[model samples]
Structure formats: C-alpha cells, structure tokens
Target chain A: AQTVTQSQPEMSVQEAETVTLSCTYDTSESDYYLFWYKQPPSRQMILVIRQEAYKQQNATENRFSVNFQKAAKSFSLKISDSQLGDAAMYFCAYRSQSAGGTSYGKLTFGQGTILTVHP
Target chain B: DAGVTQSPTHLIKTRGQHVTLRCSPISGHKSVSWYQQVLGQGPQFIFQYYEKEERGRGNFPDRFSARQFPNYSSELNVNALLLGDSALYLCASSLAGPTGELFFGEGSRLTVL
Candidate 1:
C-alpha cells in the first residue's frame, strides 16, 4: 500500500508572486508516477503536471513546474507569477507503473491544499 | 475531442437507496477509472476498467460496483447506500498504456440523506 501526504492544509500567495506547495509519499516501488491536480470552486479536477519516476529533469508547464526529489520522496509544485485564477484545491497523486500488478493504474492521493491567491 | 464526460451532475437519494453514475471516456481512450471525493478532501480511487475488464479496485466495499462497455463508456453503481456514500464521484480516462496520464471529468455529486 502507498500513501501521499500534504502537510500544508492551506496556502496563500499574492498575485504576481511565486508559491510552492509541498507533498511527500511513502512507496517502496521505484518506478511510478507523480501528479499534481487542481480543483477550483467549479469542481473540475484539472491535471496540473506530472513527473515520471525515472526522469530526473523537472517537469515544467508555463507557470507551473515541479521540483521532484525522487531519493527523498518529495514532489512539490511551484507556481510562478501566480494569478487569481490559480486559487484552488491542489492535490498530489501517485500511480504505479508496474507492468502487471493489482494496484496498477490506481491513484493514491494526498490530502489537498487549498491555495488562495490574493490580488 | 471531448474530455471524459459523466452524467447526472448532481443527485440526492435516501439511505438504503440505490444509485448509478455513468461515464464516457475520451474518444480513443480504452481505460476508465472511478474515484470518490469527500468534501474538503482529495479524491479516493474506487475502481479501474480497461478494455471492458476490471483491472484494479481500491479499498471500497462491495456496495460499490462498476463496469465498462465495449465503446469504453462506464457506470458506477452503489447499492444500499449509506450517508457516508454521499460524495463527488469522479470518472477519469486514459490511453492503453499501464502508466498513461489520466484525464478527469467534472464529477457527479451524490448526496445521500
């Protein structure tokens, strides 16, 4: 069994600034996937970014990037030039990539961090 | 191409009643997964179906059942519902690969009274 944790229950950032949300996971498997998802008040869960365990290069998507520390089992999301629309509940998720296993394809998610971007 | 789509955006049911939620994967996707999201919490995995076969299941009870059709559409049925069952039901779709990235749908919110 795997578990993800987000120690920060709430976070706030000023518009046009940068903020980072923290996440950690406990998994014995080496090959897997890590993801960040954002859910706004509209209730739509949108994929923010993803990091493959084998890849050391951090993932970047415009203003959203990830600092994935595989050895330390930490994956954090960094939002640069934040905007009001960035306010939402962000979740860290994990998925196993093993070819054949009972837990394959299921995502274990962390308790979300509600982010508030103040103008 | 439409993203994963789910039906019955919101509904209310009494305890012990039965409820069924539906999902349609992205046009070319062959894998569909279901998750439950309690308020103020992250979504929890419930089940996953690929090519109309059950590929994975979470720690949820037997009251939660789901299936995928030949066209890759899926349904989640919950029987003898309890108040604890009240939550947002989310459906996600992915490609054939075991580690394909998942695309989520706007969930179906169920309120069990």
Candidate 2:
C-alpha cells in the first residue's frame, strides 16, 4: 500500500510571499500519480495541482507548482505570491496507475497541513 | 457541466442507527468514488465504483457498503454506526480510465451522537 506523509501539521506565510508545503510518499510502483488538494474554511476540497510519476518536468498551475523528486519520493507544493484566499488545509494524495491491479485508482492521502496566509 | 453532487449536506444520527449518503457524478463521467474525511484530517478512501461495478475498496469494514446506479449515481450505506463514523463523506468523479484526476463534491457532514 502507498502512503503519503506531510510532516508539517501547520504552516503560515505572509501575503504576497512564497511558501512551500512538504510531502513525501512510500510507494514501490514506478508509475503513478501525485496530487495536492486544498480545503478552505468552506470545507470544499479543490484540486490544486497534479504530477504524474513518469514525467519529470513537474506540474504547474499558475501560482501553484510542485517540486516532484521521484527518486527521493518527495513531492512538495510551492505557492508563489500567496494571497489570503490561499489559506486552507492542504493535503497530499497518491494514486496508482497500474493497469489491472486492485490498487488502481485508489487515492491514499496524507494527514494534511493547515496553511495560513497572513495579510 | 454540473460537478459531483451529494445530498443531505448535514445530518445527525445516534449510535446503531443506519444512514445512507447519496452522490451524483459529473455528467459523462462513468466512475465514482467515496471517501471519509474527519475534522482536521485528510480524506480516506472508502470505495470506488466504475461502470456500475465495484472496482476498489479501502480498509473500511463491511458495516460500510456502497453501490452505484445505472445513471452513474452512487450511495453509501453505513449500518450500526459508531462515533468514529462521524466525518465528512466526499464523493468524487472522473473519466473512466486509469486517470487519477477527480472532481470532488462539497461532501455530506455526518455527526454521530
């Protein structure tokens, strides 16, 4: 089974600054998917970004980018020019892409890190 | 297009009671999955249904059961509820394939008393 870890239980960043949320996973599969999801006070889980294991270029969505280190099993989320709206509970998730396996499409999530963006 | 939709946004039930949560996947999506998210914690996978069939299940007990309808909508049924069953039940939908990207619903908050 694959497990995602987010060591930081809570993180804070000033508005207009940059912050990085750490994430690591334990998986034996070489091909899979990694993701970052954000849940705000409204309690809605939104997808921030995603990274495919086979791709080394990293996945970026505007202000949200990921530093995916496959060999080291690390995938960290970087938020640039943070805004107050960026404050939320961020979770790291993993999914297996193995073609005909029982583990396919099951997402394993981390404990989540609460991000606070102070104005 | 409408995103995944879950009914009964909030509900409270006592111990040993039975509860059912419903989900309607995004249009054109043939796959739906259910997850449980406790307060201050990340979502935990429960079950995944594709093409009206069970594809995967997490470590949850048999007390928790789910099924998908012909319209791609799904329902999660929990019997003999425990206080530990209190959580936000989330429903996610994605295209039918090996893809991992999923669109999530607002979730149904269940409080077990």
Cα distance off (Å), candidate 2, residue B76 = 0.2
Candidate 1, residues B7-73: lDDT per residue as tens digits?
9999999999999999999999998999999999999999999889999998899999999998989
Q: Could you give the interface RMSD of each candidate, to one decimal? A: 1.6, 1.5
Off by over 4 Å in 1: A102-104
lDDT of 2 by residue, A13-114 (tens): 999999999999999999989999999887778999998899989999999999999999999999999999999999999988788746454789999999
Residue B102's C-alpha lDDT in candidate 1?
86
| Fnat (0 to 1) per candidate | 0.68, 0.60
RMSD of each: 1.0, 1.0
Judge candidate 2 at residue A1 and give its lDDT. 78
